[model samples]
Target: MIDTARPPSVDPHMSSALLLAAAVAFAAPADDLDLTPGAWPMFRGPNGVGVGADPLPADLIRPENLRWQVDVPGRGWGSPVVADGPEGPTVYVPTATPDGTQMDVLAYDLATGEERWVRKLFTVAEPDFTHPTNTYASCTPVATRDVVFVHFGKYGTAALDTKNGHTLWERRDFECDHFRGPASSPLLVQFDGLSPRLIVPFDGVGEDDQYVVALDAATGETLWRTGRDPEVQDVVPDLRKAYGTPVLAEVGDRTLVVTTGAIATDFLDPATGERVWRVKHGGMNSGSAPQVLQSPLGVASDAVLVTTGDAPTSLALLATDSDLTQTKGAAASDPALAWSSNAGAPKRATPLLLSLGQAVTVDDGGVASMVALGSDVDGDGGEVLSRVRLGDSYWSSPVRAGGTIFTFGKEGAATTLETGVFRGGADAPPELKVAHKSTLDEGVWATPALVGGGLVLRTEHTLRFYHPDGTNE
Candidate 1:
């Protein structure tokens, strides 16, 4: 059980005006507060869905498309998040010193790729062992108009003013071993008439330590904490660790916080942090967040598509208005499972939902497949439409911009696939064509942010901005 007794340290530099603005922003209707063109609020953009409206060029490696490249001071695999500031759009990223003694959040001018501010939030005296491929700063930041929430797993979690990088409030007492390092990003949930909450998942290897905590967004006070069910905690310690992030799902008028853990995916009420339902799956060390599909399989209800960790399969849990629990362990006969497929299921990358009633998933080994979502709930859905081998490995999830899906490989390769049109029906499979393939000089583990009709990518050692017709001027 993590401690939340200590009060958050508030920065005096933050003014009341900014706090009031945050209140007003959260008070606005959800429709009016939809993600704008200038913001990439969370890990994979709004709700971690990894879809954007900007248009990215096919030839991203062309010199003419290189807007600006700046060398980042430290190392991290966290993706960059963008939000509108006073001057313009600013990019925020987290990084740690080579020795892991200092972890900081660096802000940059999105337009010119210039350094804006760097604020050190944590100093670890003795760092724990992390996987060679993972880092202490693997968690990305969530941004609002006025504040940006950053989490460094057990190191700390804080809210910073986006204007001047002032720490508004910080809570540093949450403890977790994070056996492989922290990768789950924080999620901000705001309702029409309820107080805003920042939900953080802590699925560690420690005994009886798997739980989710919600904090008051404005004050950094603990709102509620809910633990993973005891049945799911019976697994081995190594198998209990997870690096996945949580996503919000809208089921009719109710909003549920859907989180994927080692052996189970739990759905919780966003307001009370209480478990609404739990579905047990077969895999451990789950790293990919679940993707929600509305009117899934042409059904009137919504469904959640989840990837069992480190395995070659995925499961779809149909969302319903009633409370239901499925602990039968990834069986096809489970009443909660709408469908299950073993084709191109990702171990790291989150599956991308296409507009043509299809889902695209690229496994860590670079095999991308398109699965046709059938029209009815019968046995026809979850069929593999196509599969392509790209000959690369990926830790970063892919993002879709316009009609192109951009996949960033672990060894610096970028592949763009042009998704062709498909007529509505179960028989018509969508066409996927490789548009362009390019490799960078450095490795890329972080997912890029697509905003303002451009891209902000973080490589192993630097940050680079790209635009379709950008110049070095």
Candidate 2:
């Protein structure tokens, strides 16, 4: 149950009647959960590419642009997800107690900041050791027309009917050591035009027990399982763990599931969970995900970009000589080396590949740099396009919206930069132009969500909605 009785402590407040109406509207059953075109369904936008074309304001620093802000309970790094229903839209966010013993999910009205519903899912008797920076609620929720899936890594994974506050299914038997904490989020992928499968990365703390598990999205049953056996042994056991999510890419007639792990990146058949090809990288415990590059026409290319973990993090491009459909064997049919670069690779935040033949990488220390892509970037052709120092540390990945990349630091400052297009060689390298800078004045580690021409940013204690017109309910 949600506390609909109280008046929401929103900054730059609105009328009480409007908030009450919005809260009451949440009682209606969700007829549909399918995300509309302007809705943000999951992490990094719909496709996890970090590109959002929402019509948010160019400058959030403008006091008139912030619509409303509401305080959230507990601590979490998981981003908010928006799902459209028959009435309007609802934003779902998950968080947990500071002790990592109690986990809960909260629903809010997208328009008025009304408390919709709150559901508690788990209570651990003896929680595992997690890094001080990481919380128990680090995995984001994934939603569709019928169901909303919430995952807390090793704690449990559950499905809640978005229409009502009903727990449809729960799976708590999945085991993993996580070493630091659960940072990987759940991803949904469809196979053979059947029901979609929920993919969860269960990379354990040691080499002997890492696996990629897929569960039936409808029933929460085991759909398929793929184990990762990286033969490389490291002195540190945590180096064998990975906190990265998997991305699905279509290669010609074949669909490949590309995932970066502790010591290597593997491409697998999404249907059968069979490894197609793999490239070994010496870096251990990768935290960033692999991004499948797309052509200017938005077509999937054969090249995939990945970032290695540990110190001196490096970025590598793996391009297949032939169609991936015709490839078999992990190491036998490995792709040719396109190139590897160590310039400004983020250890936790995933990189974004723009349509302008450039990839944006933001390091934890706030160094944002654009590198020229394609097979030519590996050679001595001056790949580094431009770099900007934002003077803030960032833990969340940046999102592209309204032709601007919004990079939010951990301490709540957001830097907006224009994404200039890069045509080809001999052209002046694209510069990272600073468009605007704003601060939520709190801590922000979760990736922001853009939906319905609005930008939703979550700080350590508040969720703020920003729009171009600064319309507040």
Candidate 3:
């Protein structure tokens, strides 16, 4: 027998009660910085770690504590970064026009919800192919104490003054097909200690093939150029999974140029285009950027970490030595599968590897799992100690803050989970905990950008400021 519970009755006589059963899905923005102490300046908050260093309460507010939620124009998946020049900390958002008529990046004030500045900088000569989920501003802006850098293929790269929305320098001459639009976020590296280099890459094929360009930070002039063998494509190669930006890490006397291909991971000399080593982790459709881990087996050894996947298997960590370019390294350090789980790692959201080398991921299924980076073999490989299945998929990577991990799904559900996962090589997995959550419309895909005082949260059409506890001013 099937028993179906039904509504008993309506308050027919007792005057009709009017109410709005609020229904926007909740997607929690990261509280990675302090609303009273500091601000998130670039891609991964302050440094490129994708972590908010805020000491606020882990419990973020819902409709109650919300300072204010305001709707803006344009649509894209790029997170906002604050450039504190003279006008305090101004939030910068690079948005793309839907019909391709114009592609602009805008700025806002963190203190009160207000439009600080709008810069209609790039106009695509001809828009390139991109994934349904990606946008022109997919690449988050990079900043220094005085400049903000944004990359727009065909349209070129540009640098803006932090004080006023003045063009510091602009480079609208580079040419490369951003097959699936551009998602590689620019990284800032200090030249001597003050000078910065804006490293950005683009696609090309065959003899006149793919390339990664480096521009002088202060001035958007072409400082140097490095090229790669064109990815042999039968067709235009749906470049979506093929390209990525460059991330830096010191290895020996040189910094590494770990660049993601439509499907390949290559290491290049930052000073020169010399590819020091190369490793191919299958699947061309790469969404997130690559992360490096020191030889997990121990310290003092030579090893690097890489993750790839889209429709197929997603998370993978490849430990390689110098032989990777040769047949030996590839054969010897065959990727030791760390943790494989289909917990909804987004096809567009990059996977964030924590300091422990363990993967902190939010899968396409709206499920977030903190899988330990296992060193053990098959029979007892590794384990995903902590996980919480959410109700949506987030193209934005979760920002780590206050011992908790924060991620937002498609509908805008912000899930806060206690990180620190442990494999039960001897004990049991940890319990799942929900720190906070909030609601929003469809486009909160941009990863949370920690800013002055509060964390900046945005949808394609709306932007907001969230305090740690559920309090909205």
Candidate that scores best on TM-score: 1
Model 2 lDDT per residue over 380-433, tens place: 321678888986798888888757788889887788887663445556666787
| Cα-based lDDT for every prediction | 0.76, 0.72, 0.59
lDDT of 3 by residue, 1-473 (tens): 10113221221212222101111111222122112212555556644566665644556635555666777687777787876545676788788887555778787767766786788887766576665866777777775545677766655577766556567567665566665566666666553322345667765433333666655555454544565544435334543345454676555445666776655677665554456665554555565666665665232223444446554445555444333323332344233333344443445556665655366677777877665555432312225657777777666777776576778877778777775334554355454567777666554677787654457787767888886554433
Candidate 3 TM-score over all chains jointly = 0.78
The order of the candidates by lDDT, greatest first, is 1, 2, 3
Candidate 3 ranges with C-alpha deviation above 4 Å: 1-39, 125-131, 191-195, 204-209, 230-236, 239-243, 294-304, 320-346, 355-357, 375-383, 420-426, 469-473
Across 17-39, the per-residue lDDT of candidate 1 in tens digits comes to 54443332333333333233236
Clashes of each: 0, 2, 35
- Candidate 2, residue 456: lDDT: 82
Q: lDDT for model 2, on a 0 to 1 scale?
A: 0.72
**True lDDT of residue 427, candidate 1:** 59
Which runs in model 1 stand beyond 4 Å of their true positions?
1-38, 296-300, 311-335, 375-378, 421-427
